[model samples]
Target: MNIQTTLKLCSVAALAVALSACVRVSTDSGDNAAAQADAAAETLQDAAAGAEPADAFLARLARHCGQAFEGRIIANEPRSPEPHAFEGKTLVMHVRGCDDPTRELRVPFHVGDNHSRTWILTRTDSGLRLKHDHRLEDGSDDPTTMYGGDTATAGTAQRQEFPVDQASIDTFNARDGLSVSVTNVWAMEIDPGQRFLYELSRPQDDLNPQGRLFQVEFDLTRPVDLPPTPWGY
Candidate 1:
């Protein structure tokens, strides 16, 4: 090759090397920035988990969203017809519709052939709130619906307690005439990738001095197939 041609080739090779180096530097900067940003986010989440118990609990439950688990009544007291209704029937709870931005979650509880109950959890300014949304098979709201409560204490990441609030008591007495439920206290426990438990009890009083207790537990180790659309969505 001629001298000029060799000089041209060398210039082109130098330019190519410079360009490659520039590209590598750019890529390394971007990757480093992304990794640093991810680390910052994780740190913030960890701090939040330590500061807020409700947020931590909700985060754990959100992990199970879009999954359904089978459950059975583990404990019951003050024998009644309601317990019999769940006997010999498939019980399922489907965690669905997690809106983290809005801090709301909807979990549908299906008892055998009934798909009328959906448990709604919302992150209120004060604390966490639980409301029962019951609907008819045709998707109409039940008159005796929306009877749950807010968290009274800072529960653990795996467990939350909800004692019936005055609003729930008023609603129950007015709508269903069930004045005895004014002292109801409900609880939910979650063992991520293991189990979930729901419990209800009433404090001792003149109306319900014996104190009612009902509990149902779900196996979360294995997720079942999605069931039919819950009534009223």
Candidate 2:
């Protein structure tokens, strides 16, 4: 080839190599950025995965942890005979154990002098769960224990509702012959420095004239001294 043409060809080859090198550098930079972004996203997810939607509500309840409050039943009727036993007694609920990630809270309810019941709230993958843990004074499990329900929605931060689950229904039916309890719904509400309420209701039907709803409210503004240890640890 001619000298001029050969020199021109050499210049073209050098330019091509330089362009290829630039392209490789640009690709590597993009890949590194993408990797950094992915790592950041994964770290955020790890922090959030340990939290539940009902975390705010759980925190509110936890605020009262290690404290006790007096309560009184405001609604009666359509309730199991068990509630009547709490009447004419000093009703107290002591917010006991609290573990956020596992989402478990143990609040022992003291009726008059009987410390046989505990209200347990737990966090599930879907939402939340509430269970009534009853025990004898000697700490033996009650035959009709662990009957409660799971949350049906992403309830507000101040409140959450739990519609009776099948397990609760079966327990009620087997223990008390209350097959109708399958339609029961329970809810808990907390307003910091105001009041905390626990409620139960059933769907309206021929048996229930207007559907049975029972609620008990505690004075949150006042935290009384802690009571004796609950029946079960």
Identify the candidate with maximal TM-score.
1
Model 1, range 70-149, lDDT digits (tens) per residue?
99998888787664677888999999877662499899999988999999999988779999999999999988888999
Ten-residue segment with the worst summed lDDT in candidate 1?
Answer: 34-43
- Per-residue lDDT of 84 in model 2: 82
lDDT of each: 0.83, 0.81
lDDT score at residue 200, model 1, on the 0-100 scale: 91
Q: What is candidate 2's local distance difference test score?
A: 0.81
Clash count per candidate = 0, 0
Best by lDDT: 1
Query: What is the TM-score of candidate 2?
Result: 0.72
Model 1 ranges with Cα > 4 A deviation: 1-51, 81-83, 175-177
Residue 231 CA error for candidate 1 (Å)?
Answer: 1.2
Question: How many backbone clashes can be found in candidate 2?
Answer: 0
77-138 per-residue lDDT for model 2 (tens digits): 76664748768889899998875534788888888788888999998888889999999889
